[model samples]
Target: MDLDLKCKTPILSYSDDEFKQILEIRGKTLEQLPEDVNIIKEWLKMQPHLPMHPTDRQIVCFLIMNKFSIERTKEKIDANYTIKGLMPELFSKSPLHPDVQKTISLVSCGFMPKLNKKLNRVYVCRLESTDVVLLDGYNYFCSFLEMKTICDFSDSDEYIFDFSYFPMKMVTKFNPMDFKRVLTLVEKVYSNRIAGLHYVNIPSYAEAMINLIISFLKPKIRERVRIHKSLETLGEFFEKDQIPKEFGGTGISLSEICDNMNVLSKEYDEYIKESNNARVDESLRPTKLINDDFLGYHGNFKKLQVD
Candidate 1:
């Protein structure tokens, strides 16, 4: 490892047990990973559009995300950096724009630690604010995931969006275009494997809003969504302590959970700062990469995605 790569603080943190567990999840172990890293590093040197010398830890995570398929891993690395110029909204870094902070206050959100036995990390979001029609949904969702990504690296990501506190009067205030953009970022760029998406406390009045959001998702992702009339069904998927107390689970209140998340916010400030400087230089790319399956529908991806 280069001295600089070794000296830098690791961006992704997990316990020793998790380190072993994640490898086991994919039929891999620590023994052979170094060889894999070296192989990819040689490949990286030939690609001028990306950083040739990221740390071993960074390569391992990207390998895990792509299940160590060499070709897929290369594509994901390209898409990951290609993302910034393609959709900068999702990269909105911290000391967040004032509008992002405002959007956050309106929604109580957190990526909860207590995952199901399925190893699915749940991103819990609730529209906790009132009749205010939000104009900053894009910034809010983008900002939320940016901070959450550093700590939450489960094999599969799940979501529970509580629509109870929301009012029907502001339905039209939502731009499904934000939903479209968010879907694009998560599927085509982040490459986070989504296990499922759950919508709870959705009254009949709020059904259309959920439907509209679902419409923008690709079929594969849309098929993973489930709508619940109330919170009653959550117990089947999560333990009592994993679900929030307000919903009759023993877990702490949503506000408290989100407040605890602030501790991670500062931990991430420097990471996001460093990442913001790592954009892809298309002129250095070896070949033109027009939009394709892995690139999603981003019209700008002609300069992105490897294959």
Candidate 2:
């Protein structure tokens, strides 16, 4: 099947300076990492079962993630494909069933239509229901991951996680194992893509929850996670006019943005299904055992250190 890897979402309009900066990064990456394309081609040659033909943008994403270090890029590329292959339930394509749709509707997560002043795409996530477990939060979370394929354009994307309505009970429902999966995907696969993660309207107990999540993250990523006391504090990173009205900004509502995303999700369903073929086939791989431990944690969640 011919996979359409084209970004379906409207590309963020960058300022002259931002555009120039992007070009400089891309040019430098190409110069420093000239063998990047050939590296992927050679890797693909080994994985006969994997049906992916990565685009220039996709290859560049890994390059930028590793700061143009060819060795690190190759390592990341290998880990990324391996994880996708191993965890088909999480990474593979499945129909966006009604249950998934219901979860998505409850958990409003999507990229804001507009870019911040720094030309970074802002991603907004809010949980409307405190019964996160019943909401099938894992699959709901996966929907945002799927959306990122099309929405993630800039080298650095800003994240706004609204926890105003999130209660302590709901926080407990979040499985540490699932949290580990998210961190692994972001750190290992989607590295350097996140500019900053702003947690606004944080509940008093949210700090503990935040700490638990950050413990799974790398130091660099942990540093980027900022807790905002109010929307005013968040405004330091994003303009008030650009923010959605739900978050005390003058822009559109979160529901409206999510509505748009829902439409896009339906349209891109085919692409998501086709992309599953891109996962590496470990059976055919020469390297039989890569470090499959995504977060390096084992045993029951209760035993895991949350503090």
Candidate 3:
């Protein structure tokens, strides 16, 4: 029987009263129809193998009325039910095709159809060794996947403390006042350390708070502010990511340090208004003003000469 397994077998034609109603209704042995599937592995192949093609039986009966088990395919044939009977009203109205929402997030555990943005709904659940069920009840995707798996095991040492000194350790951990308050304290320290500060001794406390805010802004810009050659050229360009956040630029030349701190705060407010007008013209001098009769002329006008 080896003419390549008799030309890869699949040739049944039967019709003698449909093989006598399949040998009087019960006993069956026809087989060979399974192989079709390919509309990109029946919608993106992440563990597909179900009964599949008969034009994907209304998407495998809307993934078995959204329960998602799959692996039958013997050929029962007969259940169009228009889009599997409007899949509970098409997932309760709208947004499916991201390959039928990742085949309803790979049949339920490795779930991904999110869109919850405050209950807008596509129902979120299933990703923890997945079993494929989330049609609307995995309690907000297993409490946001166990809060992102305990925030990825508490930031497994903060992305190895290297986001090019994440905007200079978030503008020296909020020592903000300008440079647009250090870019709003680097967007609230990278959105609260990528949402819930896990850990890795926070990049040596973000490299000693960005080396104390770039050595306190190079000694307030050089009045003998010897910042050891601008903190060793911004600590070797913040350890080689090339600086710019306004001279400390990681997000590069951060608006030239807010235009050099608004042109050095308008030249330190015109040098404190010309040093308070030269200390009021060297402590200004003034003479006394005479009053009344001038004390009847000093010693009676040198003894009675009526001047």
Model 3 Cα lDDT, one tens digit per residue, 121-199: 1111112223322333222222222222111111101111123223332433343232322222122111111111111
Q: What is the lDDT of residue 278 in candidate 3?
A: 25
Provide the overall lDDT of each model, using Cα atoms, as 2-decimal numbers: 0.66, 0.63, 0.24
10 residues in a row with least lDDT, candidate 1:
3-12
**Each prediction's TM-score versus the true structure:** 0.83, 0.78, 0.14
lDDT (Cα, 0-100) at 125 in candidate 1: 79
lDDT of 1 at 227: 82
For residues 52-167, write the lDDT of model 1, one tens digit per residue: 34556666766776787777767766776776666665565452446656666777777665555566666787887764335455554554454434444557788888777877
The lDDT-based order of candidates, best leading, equals 1, 2, 3
Lowest-sum lDDT 10-residue window in model 3: 1-10
lDDT, residue 119, model 2: 63
